[model samples]
Target: MTPSTAEHPQMSVEDFEDLARHAPETVTLEFINGKLEVKPVPDGDHVTIFMWLLRQCMQARPDLDLHPEQGLKVGTYRNGRARPDGALGPVGHFAGQGEWADPAGVLMVVEVTSHDSGTDRRDRVEKRDGYAEAGLPVYLLIDRDADAVVVHSAPRDGRYAEITAYAYGATVTLPAPLGITLETEGLKDYSL
Candidate 1:
């Protein structure tokens, strides 16, 4: 279930939105550097991991609101958009209507690795820079390939200044803004 691109090589945000309106609901696309990056639909393991994390966050921090597949405005170029696996922010931060929400409203963004190697690389590298540049406080990456969770924080210049990685079954402490520890017990490895 790889993503398919449009005939045009690049597109503006407005143009991407227009195309998305007619696109199938099952397809997930991210406009990046003027090109649409089609994302594969989530498999069962992906869904299970996402739900588990969402529930954990909700239970641990009832003050924050979590949204799945929520679009984020990352840069001023209008050349891209980012939709994290899960976005955490103050309650009602995304209550309005639009194709994307301001990155300022997002406290953290989480990305779970996909089966595609390219996608996984993008999540670990490209998207990390993008989120940092956008000034998001945290970027939590659940890397199935490594069977570990990595947290990136303290954005500076165009990257996170601090990073900590923990294997499954270990607790990862989120910094001040989040002020909570994520217990990774029972997290399963990817079967793909």
Candidate 2:
């Protein structure tokens, strides 16, 4: 059975982390406002699009490092932290910073939107704000059902001023840090 975004009783971040540590591997938890929300894994289309996008980035710049679904802490005072679908960073970006690189230094962040209502809202709204507030320059959203990719950039005063969308067959140009024109053909046959 798939995980649902049911309301979880309020718990501190530490509590959430502790629970997550012992949680079964089959489950994925995302903390929101001190509550742990179970996030269902992505469907076929979501993974397909994500892999294609990652491949594009890898092919364009072999030196770049692209990580899938890694936890990252952002926002001032770590008010909000999340594990995005994919995050791009320079080679050795975390050389002396340990395994996880600082979210503030991330080059790009991508979220593969799920069908769940709460997941969709969090990906489209909450994350957008969180990433912006952390000053992440580029944010990408791959909407499966919509069969579209949304790119957000140009953070001004802790908000994204430029938002664009591209459907299949369209070349989506990303902003700086993740500069690349993704061809639509590769992402066309995905379930989205």
Per-candidate clashes come to: 0, 0
Per-residue lDDT tens digits of candidate 2, residues 32-111? Answer: 54445677788887887788888899998778877887676654445544778888888766557542346867888999
Candidate topping TM-score: 1
What is the lDDT of every predicted structure here? 0.80, 0.74
Q: 1-192, model 1: which lDDT tens digit per residue?
A: 334322333756787778876789998887754467787788888888898888888888998987899988774342468788999998888888476877876899999888885775478876787788788999999888778899999999878999999988898889968987888876755434
Which regions in candidate 1 have their CA more than 4 angstroms from the true location? 1-9, 76-78, 189-192
Clashing pairs in 1: none
Worst 10 residues of 2 by lDDT: 1-10
Task: Please state the error at residue 53 of candidate 1 in Å.
Answer: 0.9
